[model samples]
Target: MTIRFPTLSFAAVRAELLARREIALLDVREEDPFAQAHPLWAANLPLSKLELEAWRRIPRRDTLIVLYGDHAGSDLAPIAAQRLAELGYTRVHVLEGGLDGWREAGGELFRDVNVPSKAFGELVEHERHTPSLSAQEVKALIDAKADVVVLDARRFDEYQTMSIPTATSVPGAELVLRVRALAPDPATQVIVNCAGRTRSIIGTQSLVNAGIPNPVAALRNGTIGWKLAGQALDHEASRRAPEAGEANRAVARASAQEVAQRAGVKCIALDAIESLEAPDRTVYRFDVRTPEEYEAGHLPHFASAPGGQLVQETDHQAPVCGARIVLADDDGVRAPMTASWLAQMGWEVYVVEDHPTSARQVRGAAAPVHPDAPVVDEVSVTELARHLRESPGTTAVIDVTAGVNHARRHIPGAWFAIRAQLAQAIEAIQPARRYVLTCGSSLLARFAAKDLRSLLKARGSEAEVSVLAGGNAAWFAAGEPEESGWKNVATPATDRYRRPYEGTDAPAEAMQAYLDWEFGLVAQLAADGTHHFHVI
Candidate 1:
């Protein structure tokens, strides 16, 4: 039975959005290709991992979902629509002309992930006139050893990769929390930067909004601008801002709380969060602290969503656009600062005020336990290696790691498979007496093994299933040899997409084109008046 998906035109989709309707504009492609171009509100829900992530991202099965892709004679959109139907989505449609159709309809297409928030940041700067300093001016200040502190507003890993000569890693959300300790003197000029313009502008504005005492400015266009200006960047920089003293923490907390209050962000008690979780409403509880801190201990029912990344990738984290968001942090500073921006971005956001030590806590990978997880059997890496050596053709080894990780390295004989396409993948493989599943950390592998066992059982097959304990990490730690590249793939390698601006091998023209697209986002925002952004 062939299913024909209903198609929605670009004009109709735009009308639905402008009318404040609840619709999920899903770009059913891998992140890399999706990053090349997409509409501002389009969320990347790659068909490869749809089964694993669909239920969590789009919680309401009845929600309106319009799927699109490159669609140059490809079945990606139709296949994705079928998958959504299988998952019980009631209102799913395919975009009429796909990406090309939208482009022809005079719609604005943006490059890179999180285009909506990034474009909004650009719009904010255009409206608010966020202050900035050129790379050359910053370099002159560094040479003269002026009273200035350079704060890299990107993630720690990005700052470590490449940074200004004397910049300290103080990610965007931390600027309000840690700036006072880094610069006690009121006269010390502060500069914030990221890989590009968005984070730099937002970070500088965050401090400015909080009424910080010191003069602050963004490194105009950030590292890309520095490279364009021919300024040398230091690699593997380890400098970081110091922790705040008690007095400074008090001051920062007061300032951030005031800013959040002005932005219409609410502060809620732990007990009050439950009332917000009724069936009629969707509420996301997040710990907006660093990953390390969240792992040590965090309140139960809260997912670890580092503040800066959460703000940068809100669509990915909380796909339910109109849902209420509650942020938590042990220190009072981060949540309020993050919530302030989210409120301005038009989210009904809140911060957790009092910390409760009585709540249960979990550690490490934070994998959600499946109800039938205990039924799956487990095998150690050494045992799997021995089984492969003793009975090569009888046992099938499937690596369910992310596509990019599998491409970099994997067990020599394992076939790469997407967890969502388990049944199709198993059918494609030669029938075997036994199967072993593994991923980067084995958390997802356990879930996959349970699913595969149930599927094989329903089919009346005698195949046994087990997960490799500790997964690929244990395989490497056990001194086992591995292979690299996209050979022996059980499914298409489309699970992961390659970014156009990722590595040095990318064409210079593509990189410049991406920048040019970003430069014109303000105009596009004006054309599409759906974004409800208010600059504070």
Candidate 2:
């Protein structure tokens, strides 16, 4: 039986956005393809990993979800709609004529991930005339050891990977808070940069807006421009912004509070957060601190969304364009800095003022397991190894870890499969009497095992399913043999779309092309004319 889904016209979707309605215009395609061309507000929720991310990205099931894909040949919209419906989404629809239809209807398509945020950054620069110095100019200043400090406004890991010489790791939100401490002399020149334009522009403008005494400018085009200018970049540098003093903290609190207030951001307490939780509104509570800090301890019910990455990838972080976002941090700096950008991006954002004094705090990156998560039986890694040794063909091991992690190291003979593609993955594997699921930790594998059991039960198969206790780490600790590479992959590892600017091997041409695309986003935003951005 063919299932027909409701179709939304491109014009209708545009109207919905213009009307400020809660809509998730999703493009269920792999990241690389989706980045090539997509509607400005279309969130990339690839069908391949829908089960793993859909719930978090689009929290409300009743949200008006209109999915589209490459409609040139193969249509993925209907299939995605079916999957979303199965996942309990009530108001699911497919875009009529898909991408082609949107193009025909005069919809402005954007290239690259985080289109809305990047475009907003460009708009901010255009409106405010954010100051910037070219790579050569900044390099000359660094060579002369002038009264200058270069601040890398990217994540620490990104800064460690590659950065401008003499640049300190001071991520975007940290700029306003830590700059005073880093540059005590008012005559000092402060330069901010990231791999590309958005963070550089945002970070440089942040200090300027906060009335920092130092002369500030962005290292134009960041490390990319540095490399392009035949200037060498420093790798594995460990310089970081110093901790703010009481005086610095007081100043930052005042500056960030003023910025947040000007942006219409509300200050909410923990009790207020609880009250905001409702069936009708989708609220995203994020602790916009560094991952290391978040891992040390953070408030319950708040996910780790490092301030810099959250702003860079807002579309990926919050799919519902008009959703309310509440940001939290131990200090008053990161949350307000993050909330200000979110506000300018058209979200109803807030900063949590009260600290998590009495609230529960957890360690590690894994979010607390949902109460409704399915329960599955578990077996020890040693037991699984014995079973594999005894009945090699009868027992099958499925490693439902991230594709990149699986490629690095996995249990020998374990087939790599994404949790979202378990049903199809099981069918592709040779018939076995039993199946074992595992990830880096058993947390995700247990959920995968439950899914596998459901798929088996639906097919009336008697195959037993269980999660590997302690997962692949336990298997390695027990001295079990392991393998590497993409051999025996059940699904193509389209789970993560590689960024053009990530890693050292990206083609120079591609990087240049990416920069060119970003440079034109202001014009694209002008053409679209729907983004309600108000720079503070």
Candidate 3:
């Protein structure tokens, strides 16, 4: 059967991006290669996980999806196009000539993930000239016990990992509303910092844009600069911003509204949602509150995306560039502030006026809709444990979870295998009487079980195949013995991109390189000319 899909040239896709026509330029390769280099706007959707992620990430079935993945001997885009076609996506296309074609077409390539947001941060500073203070300057202020408040604009976990001395966790979206409570005095010098420059710049700019009463500036180059300056950081810090008072909330709302209006963000009430969501277009509804707040109560169909992370990683949150985005927050401050940044990033953004209440609230995370998997044989955790104990080597357990997860924990001797490269894994593992497949929740394992069956059948092997009833999570929940580390890694763990800014163990050189790369993103954006970004 021919896998039918159109081929889009670089010029064509660029036109769509510039025109504000929605398109998801997906690099259907694992995160590792996709991170090394790709078009500035390309989002990573590894072919192996496409079945599980495509529907959720892309959202709209008719979205203009352009995929490309072609390495020396492996070509994944065609296979990915077929898979998307099977999933009922009608407007799929392959980037003409794959990544090579993109480079040949003179496309500006960027390294690392979330290039759009990072580059936009640099551009924001360039255009707005967002004020900043060097790490040494900030350290001196802390040493002097001056009238200053340091706000960390990264996720709470990231702040807890390693933070500047005396810094409080006030993630991006929470800054405006919570800052007043943290620093009631209008003259207090407020300094913002993140692990690196992007969030720091964006968070500081957010305060500046919202007209916060206190004098504000970013900790230049963020923590990376702090480390380079020979400063020690606090570890296991638990400090966070306090809740805002009613008066502070009122002031924040007014300021955010003005900033949003300046950035050209649209506002719509709950009742007008139908009009905002045209069937012909894609509209993403995100609740830009803390995850805890969102899980307690949120509007149905609204996914939780903390405002700061949403701005820092827009490509990951909403891969369909140019799609309409609707942000929600009960306080009315976070949503509008987030909308302001997204609007300048060239997204048609909106802030929802309706608030979530317990009367009509939906609890917990928004689960993605997944296609039904073909029926396959299954073995429960207890049964698998018994089989492993009794049958020994006859039943080989293959763990099909993400490499990082597999390395972290797995059933004692399960071999790690990527679902896309299952055949290679099967060939490497010795012949067995039966095979048991599992993953985090068994969701991905169920799909992989079907693939394993077909591969075994094609080779004319009569081995029995089964999926672990609830996968690794169930196994762990049942007190089953687990092992850690890269044991029996049959396939390279290319599914994840190791972020240079994450984890305290990152080398100084790598962190400096990451900072160096950010400094040049503005020039790259200029060369690309596809990002229709602006600054207020």
Model 2 agreement with the true structure over 1-536: per-residue lDDT tens digits: 55899999988898889888889999987776788889999999877557667887887889899999763367878878987888889999999989999999999988878888899999999899999999999999989989999999999999999988888999888888899998999999999999989999999988887889899999888888888788888889999989999999999988888888888889987778877767777889898887888888878778889898899889988999777899998878889988988998889998887665556367778554232445778899779989989878999999988888999999989899867667668768998999999898777787678778879998999999988888888999998899999888886776677877877667788889888988898899989888888887
| lDDT digits (tens) for residues 1-536 of candidate 1 | 56998999999988877765667899987776787778888999876566667877777677788999663356478878987897888889999889999989988877778877888789889888999999899999999999999999888988987888999999888888899999999999999998778889889999998888899999987877777777788989999888888898899999989999999999898889998867545678888888888888888778888888888889998876567899999778899999998999888898998776555266664665222234468898888999989998889989988988998999988889977568768877888889999999887788688778878998999888999998999999999999999777787765655544333344556556666777898888887666878878
Candidate 2 has what TM-score?
0.87
Candidate 3, residue 239: Cα displacement in angstroms equals 1.1
**After superposition, candidate 2 runs with Cα above 4 Å error:** 1-4, 69-83, 274-279, 295-300, 354-366, 369-380, 383-398, 417-438, 442-469
What is the TM-score ranking, best to worst?
3, 2, 1
What TM-score would you give candidate 3 relative to the actual structure? 0.97
Candidate number that wins on lDDT, 2 or 3: 3
Off by over 4 Å in 1: 1-12, 69-72, 78-91, 96-106, 355-365, 369-400, 413-438, 441-471, 485-511
> Which has the higher TM-score value, candidate number 2 or candidate number 3?
3
Q: Which ten residues in a row have the lowest lDDT in candidate 1?
A: 499-508
**Candidate 3 lDDT tens digits, 288-330:** 9999999888887888999999999999889998888998989
lDDT of each: 0.83, 0.86, 0.90
Highest TM-score scorer: 3
